[model samples]
Target: MYNNKFYVVQDGEFVNPNTNHLFSNGLDPKDFIVNQDGERYNFVGFIFNSEKILISFPKHSFSSTDLEKLPQNSVMLNKYIRILFNCIKRTVNNRNDKYVGIRNELNSDYPFIDFLEVYKYYKRYGLFTNEKEIKKFGYAGRISWKDTMNKSPKIINNHNLLFLPLIIKENIEQHVFISKCMAYVIDSTLERFSLFLEGEKTNLHTRDIDFSNTSLVITQLKKVKRTLFKNIHQHLVDSLISFFEQEKTKGGNYQLKIYSFHLIWESMIKEYLRTKFYGLNDRLEIEWSDSARNNHFEKKVAYPDMRGMNGFSIEPDYYLILNNKRYIFDAKYYQKLTKLDYKQVAYYFLLKHFETNRDVNGNIINELETYNALILPTEYEIYSEVHFELNPEYNVNESKFVIMAYYLNTLKVMEHYTNAN
Candidate 1:
């Protein structure tokens, strides 16, 4: 947090819902923390309301809230935001085969808003018992036979806890409260993003639902838990709860724990390479091998047990062969590759020892290049790669990197991460 504010564009910063919420201050990234060692976070268009940290759907689509500092120009900011969006998407897609998702709408007609604003547009503002109409029953409630006898005036007066006229509509009370809470948030959302009249929110449902009560909305949403029906799915209820919690601060602080983002980064890098070399197998033909020459991209090398039945499948981050040369890629999310790292070496020797995959010469696959790289999401014009020399004296067997350590340009790959196959 910087200046006691998170580095994320607040909902209030957005002027309109169109243009995908870009070209507005609201989409500006802020309070971005990558690794465990949290540092100062300060950036324009990023001060927000969430006290802790969370992500919010400001522009209809969801994306990670973390971003590295870049040029202050709108053009740069907009591109970076797009990159972050694609990065998270790639990350999600990598973890799961497909995207099974759920989220509430950001703008336009809200579900609750349509019910009050457009659906009831024709109904004039009048007193009705629908909800929030505090109707009072003037006459007394039920009277028992003993009350008419007036045997004891005190006993008759204090019959049933002294009150029967008070009718607590428990069901409607929750709905009304929820609707009011939703309306308050919707109006606040419109106030920040849309150009509407002061009281022109909709056909005035009633003064009971405060049109401009952000404080009340936040307090109720964050503090007051509504008693929903038992029939409602817990997931749906949880989603609603999350929605309300997120709305507590329209300009919510999105925090990304970027430490464990290696898996996602690896996925992004793999996808990018796959796109670049789409028809790779057609160009390379070998006598014996698994589907690496066909359609299987992320193939694992499994060495059977003593029984040669089933053993753990040892797999590299990515493996592919082109032009009679094998390529092994490890998409690492670190500052730099270290000498201590030996996974790439293991992959190199494993491929060399594996008998199934070999060149036409009949020797172990000789053409092998491993790239262990750190991914940086910045505006680096060109990507450069350098080979890391290993010292042989350290260990007896581990010599020079059979699995070569290479520095890859990550920003360049992300450019095509979300591109078509």
Candidate 2:
């Protein structure tokens, strides 16, 4: 522990500590130990006061109560710490395949602890409460003779009589439903924590996570069963893979893991908007780009171009379609929007209006209305909405560009969206 502030150490270096209540002035780059790469990690939004350290990670701001729930050496402390360490390790090793762009944005010095906070936000706000289809294997269910033949004879013979084997099949669970996946993650985390509390050593080379847990309420999860007919909870499964999978570095010497906070923030906003506006109008539709290829555009030039390229592809964050109008929104975690940011979104607007002017139908569209906005996070109570009119030379009709800042507090977001006119 540094100055009586308890910190978990992995290989003599502080991994993830409770910096919310730490003494900010005491937090110096030189004070913390370096990683395996021989570099000191940078703690983003870390303020060292004389008495305590105020740490502001993504999705964790303006809320002291949430911080209080996670105190130093708490029962559930190891899970959070393990999460932080794994996330950083994953990003550093380039094991994060889902959010490649966001992973590229991560630096070696970025704090792992802050990444944990962003994951918490995803768990609370982004994940849905629906069931998904997963493959399951068990002897309690019945199946066709052909299906039973696919399973191992030993398992079938051991669980059932030879004559009745054809009537029953071994249940093979393979799909991931929302509730079951949640339970699996919770139970799996608790089991790992139990190992730490019981002084059991994991196969992991590092001894960063070793602690006791208070109790985990998993009674409801135990009742969930895998079903083949259920729909796949794609969002929940995508989010849970980071926590469930055991990803290792290229050298296979250590484990690497993390949930993408960039994706989490975008998902939270998308879900919030959907929930808030779903019942507003029957014709309203919200669409996500999902990938660059989905929203890509090709601009063909007749003459020679600067890069000698025929076209370029552009992808926006999200699209809100209300009747014949389209609103583009880009969620930014930065404190302020820059000129380049504005230009990028404006370019997206130009593409959607001019190049991709067709609707869901194949009918040609002559004119289109488009609006673009940049959503930024702030710590203060200032409610500022700024708009910039596009140049008239573009010849676009009813084009609007806006930069809106909102408080980083999740509660504020809910309140504003739920009560907005």
Which segments of model 2 are wrong by more than 4 Å?
Answer: 1-56, 63-97, 100-260, 278-310, 338-340, 355-366, 379-384, 390-408, 411-421
In candidate 2, what are the lDDT values of residues 1-421, reduced to their tens digit? 1342333222222334554123433445543446555533233322323223233244433234444555464555444443333333333444436556445434223222233322343456443344334334445655555555565354446577553344453444342233444443444343432312122222222122221110112222222322223334333343444333322222211111122455545544554454443321222223323231222111222212234355554456666555565556666654335455664445544555444456688656665455555555543442435435455567555344443333344434433333333
Write down the TM-score for model 1: 0.44
Q: lDDT by residue for model 1 over 59-103, one digit each (tens)? A: 212123322232234355456445644555445433364322201
**Global lDDT of each candidate:** 0.39, 0.39
Error of 1 at 372 (Å): 9.3
Candidate 1 regions with alpha-carbon error over 4 angstroms: 1-71, 93-242, 245-257, 278-296, 299-301, 304-313, 321-325, 355-402
RMSD of each: 14.7, 15.2
- Candidate 1 differs from the real structure by a C-alpha RMSD in angstroms, to one decimal, of 14.7
